[model samples]
Target: MNAGKLACSLLLSLLTAQLPACSFNMNVESMLSPPRLTAEQEQIYQKLQNSVGSQQVRLKY
Candidate 1:
């Protein structure tokens, strides 16, 4: 009975020790926003947006 109890305690401690390895810590600054686009890129983006428009066209019966 004592051996069984010791084995259970050992297993529990090992499982707890391994828990931290599965956890993650996220740093806020590491996930900062992306840099802004240049003026020429912005113009191209606007043109693409205008071509797409605000409608969802469908072609099914």
Candidate 2:
């Protein structure tokens, strides 16, 4: 590979090694702020919010 591409590849590899994939987690509130919505979007967002009050259990084997 060319020098520039090689340097980028090495930098990315080092970054990933130091910070494994699971170490990165997004802050949901900022990612999805309340926005102006149409009727359908509002309805769906309400339904999603309602579901948050309920709990769903999962078994990871």
Candidate 3:
């Protein structure tokens, strides 16, 4: 019984640690009006935004 409790506690701790890492807030408007990016940087930024957007959606669900 003690071992089972210990395993459950450890699992919970690991999950909570990961939760903080998943916690993210982005302000895309800050980027929108910023100085222009080089073509390569713009493409990369767009890809990042798309990826983050998807992640945000998943988190909301």
lDDT of 2 by residue, 1-61 (tens): 6999999999999998987556545788667754577899778767776787666533233
lDDT of 1 by residue, 1-61 (tens): 9999999999999999988886555888877766666899778767777788996433232
Candidate 1 lands at a TM-score of 0.38
lDDT of 1: 0.77
Q: What is the C-alpha lDDT of each candidate?
A: 0.77, 0.72, 0.73
Stretches off by above 4 angstroms in model 1 are: 1-31, 55-61
**Top-lDDT candidate index:** 1
Q: Which parts of model 2 have CA positions greater than 4 angstroms off? A: 21-61
lDDT of 3: 0.73
Specify the poorest-scoring 10-residue window by lDDT in model 2.
Answer: 52-61
Candidate number of the best TM-score: 1
Q: With candidate 2 superimposed using the best TM-score fit, by how many Å does residue 19's alpha carbon deviate from the native?
A: 0.9
User: Which is the better candidate, 2 or 3, if ranked by TM-score?
Assistant: 3
